[model samples]
Target: MTDDRPQGTFVLLDLDGTLVASAPGIVASLRHALHTLGRPAPAEATLDWVVGPPLRRSFETLLGEGGDVEAALALYRASYEAEGMFLSVPYPGIEDTLSALSEAGHRLFLCTAKPLPHARRIMAHLGLDAAFEGLYGATFDDRFDDKATLIAHILDERGLSARDGCMVGDREHDVLAARRNGMTALGVTWGYGGAAELAESGATRLCQSTGDLAGDVAALLRSETGTRAPVA
Candidate 1:
C-alpha cells in the first residue's frame, strides 16, 4: 500500500488520445483551418493520426512543406476556442482509473503536446483538473511541441528524476519521449495508437483496457518501490 522508495513515483499523462477522445474537436478545428486557408480537407478517416501529434506538425503534413503552419494553427485555434474544444469527452472509466491511481499515492501530472492553455481548458471542461497535481504542456508558440521537451520541462521544473517516474500515453511519441528521458513508458491501446505502434515504440507495458492500465500502474509502482499495493 505504501511506497518504500525514498522518492514517490509520478506519472505523466498525455491529454488528447490518452485521457480524452479529442479527435472530433481537433479534426473539426483542422478542417476549419484548412477551409479558411482555401485548402481541401482530407477525408475524416485520414485524420485519426492527427490526435496525438503536435498541431503544427499535423498541419504541416496536410499543408505541405511550404505551408503556413502558423496561420493554419491560428485559424484552428480560433474555431477550437469558439466551438470545438468542448467537443471532446473522456475515455470510458478514465476518471475511476485516475482516482484509483491518486488514491494509491502516486502523483499524477498532465504532460501533453497541446498548448498549455488549451490543455488546462480541456481538463477543466472534463472536471479532471483536480486529479492532477500539475499540468505541463507545450507553449502557444509551440516552444515545447514534442513530448520529450515537455517531459524534460516537467522534470526540471519539479526537481524530479525520470527514474522516479513514468509516462502513460497512446502514441509512439510518448513512448519514445519516456525512453529518451530514461523513464518507463506505459501505452494504452484504447486510444488512437494501436498495439503495434506501442510495441514498436518500446513501451514498457501495454494496457488493453482501463482495468489493465490500473493493474499495470500498480504493479510498476510496487516494483519500483519494492512494496506491495493494497488489495482492492
Candidate 2:
C-alpha cells in the first residue's frame, strides 16, 4: 500500500497556551501548592505567566530566595496530577485546525515545557494524541525544561534540520528556542503570551486567530521550504 500524503514541514507545537488553554488547571495547581506551603500566591492578573514557563522557575519567583521551591513543586505536582491536569480544553477550532494541518501533510509534534508523562496523559485524555507524530517535553528532573535544550535535542534525535522546522508556540521561550536553533518561529496570539511578547521575542510570524492558523502555518512553512520540494 503506497501512502500518498505529501511530506509536510516539521511543525513543533507548544502544548499549553498554544494547542490547549491549560491555564485554569496550571494556575489552580500552583495556587493549591502555595496555599499548602502557606505562601502567598500571585494576584489573578499575573497568574497567567506561570502557564508557559517551567513550574520550578515560577515557584522560585513566587516563593522568593529562601523559599522551598522543591517542596512547592512537589505540592504542585500532587495537586495537578490529582485533578488539575484535566481542567483544560482545546482552544476553539483547534481540533479542526490540527486535522487541516495534518491533512495538508504537515508533520506535527508536540514540543512543550510540560513533563512528558503528564503531557502524554493529557493528550490521551483530550483525545488529541492521534494528531501528533511525537511528543517532546521535559522530564520529571527538569533536565529538558528549558525549551531551547529540548528543541535542540528534538532536532538531533529526529535527524531534522533547524532549517526544515517551524516552532509554533505562544511564549517567548518558544520563540527564543526556535531562534537559538535557527528554526522559524510562529506565535499564536490566542495564547497566554499575547502579541507583544511574541513580537518582542522575534517571532517570524504571529497568528491572530485559530481560524487563520492553518493558512498562516502553511505560508510560513512554504516560505521556509521554498524551491525545495516536499520530502517523500
Candidate 3:
C-alpha cells in the first residue's frame, strides 16, 4: 500500500541510525559504561549495529543478567548526558531529504526508541528537532517498551491518519511495529539493518540509499493509494 503523493503524506522517521548518524556517541557511552560494569563492550562494529535499537536490549545482551540494568542505563547516561551525545553526525543528505519532504507538504514525525530527554537532545543538537512536525520517543516516564505501542501513541496524539503514515527506519523493530499498527515499513539499507532481516520483518519497501529514498518518495508525494518503494 504505497502512496505516491506529494501532499497528505505523513512520514515517520526513526531518529538514530535512520535519519541521524548516531553511532559514535552511542558507542562511546556504551563502551564507558561496560568497562565500569566489569563487562567488555561489544566490538565496534557490533556497537555501531546496535545504535538503532533500544538501550535496555543492548545492555541485556552486552552486560548479562548479572549486570544491573538500571545502573548500566545510569552509567551510559552519564557520558551520554555530558558529552558523548554530540559525538555523532548526521549522514549527508538527510537534511536535504527532510527539507524536500517539508516543501512537498508532507507531515514529518520522528519515531524512536531513544529515551525522551536523550532523543530530544540529539534532535536539538543536530538541528533536526525543527524538521519534524512532532517527535515520539520511548521513555521510562511513559513506560513505553515497544515500537508498535509508541507509534500508535504518536498517531493518536498527533491526530495522524494511519493509512497516510509510513515508517522509514533501519531495523526489524521498526518494520514489525508498522505491521502491527497496520502501516507501511520502508527499510533503509544505508543504515544498520541488513536486507534479509528487514524483508523478513515485513518491510514493504527497502531503499538502497538516502538519495534513492528521496526519489522513490517523490512519486509518493502525489499518490493516495501509495506506490511500492524501490528495494534495490
Per-residue C-alpha lDDT of model 2 across residues 11-118, encoded as one tens digit per residue = 999999988999998999999999999988776667998988998898888889999988988999999999999998999999999999888888889999999999
Off by over 4 Å in 2: 1-8, 224-232
Model 1, TM vs. native? 0.92
TM-scores, all candidates, are 0.92, 0.92, 0.89
lDDT of 3 by residue, 56-157 (tens): 888888777687988888898999989888887888888888887777678888889888788888888889889788878888654665888898898888
For each of the candidates, give the backbone clash count: 0, 0, 14
For candidate 3, the per-residue lDDT at 199 reads 89
The 10 consecutive residues of candidate 3 with the worst lDDT sum are 223-232
- Residue pairs with colliding backbones in model 1 are none
For model 1, the run of ten residues with the poorest summed lDDT: 223-232
- Report the candidate with higher lDDT, 1 versus 3: 1
Comparison by TM-score, 2 against 3, better one:
2
The sequence of per-residue lDDT tens digits that candidate 1 reaches over residues 33-122 is: 999999999988889999989888888889998999989989999999998999989999999999988887779999999999998998
Higher-TM-score candidate of 1 and 3: 1
